[model samples]
Target: MFKVVICDDERIIREGLKQIIPWGDYHFNTIYTAKDGVEALSLIQQHQPELVITDIRMPRKNGVDLLNDIAHLDCNVIILSSYDDFEYMKAGIQHHVLDYLLKPVDHAQLKLF
Candidate 1:
């Protein structure tokens, strides 16, 4: 089973994702959630999830910094952001992020991965 970690500053977003995703159908069993990048990092270290979906602009660490810190780890990353500009997208691409989703996340889009 694939393990997944989801991190976002907004409580609603985090809860929404947890409720919406049909994790078991996608071979994902363990799901972890956090409110900030710092907390996410701690969960990542402990869980070593196969995938990490995190918000780009979050308190304490941000998605980019967390990705950089875990660059050597064997985990795929999905970045979530309200910004759809080239700069953030470029950075995510450069870092080889698995995917990026804009705010007000689309369940269909997320399930594509």
Candidate 2:
């Protein structure tokens, strides 16, 4: 079993993902949620979850900064973005993210990742 952390500034997004995803089906045993990148980073450093799903435009520390910060960690990241910007996509590529899902994230798409 693995651990996963879901990070987003919005309460609905954080809670929705946590509840909607059938994490156990994907072999995830522990699930954690964070309100922003700052808290997410702390949780990442502490728990070292196998996976992280984070929003791009968060306060405190944006997804780009978080990606850079976790570049050395041995965890897979899936970015959640509301915008279809190339700059963000470029960053995700540079950091070797597992996948990037635009918001109103598609559950079927997420499962494929």
lDDT score at residue 23, model 2, on the 0-100 scale: 86
lDDT of 2 by residue, 1-113 (tens): 89998999999999998888888889998999998899999999999999999999999999999999999999999999898899999999999998988889756779524
How well is each residue in 2-59 modelled by candidate 1, as lDDT tens digits?
Answer: 9989899998988888889888888898889999989999999999999999998888
Each candidate structure's TM-score, on Cα atoms with residue i matched to residue i, is: 0.93, 0.96
In angstroms, the error of model 2 at 4 is 0.5
Error of model 1, residue 78, in angstroms: 0.8
Candidate 1 to truth, TM: 0.93
Residue runs of model 2 more than 4 Å from their true location after superposition: none
lDDT of each: 0.87, 0.91
Clashing pairs in 2: none
Residue-level error in angstroms, candidate 1, position 12: 0.6
Candidate topping TM-score? 2
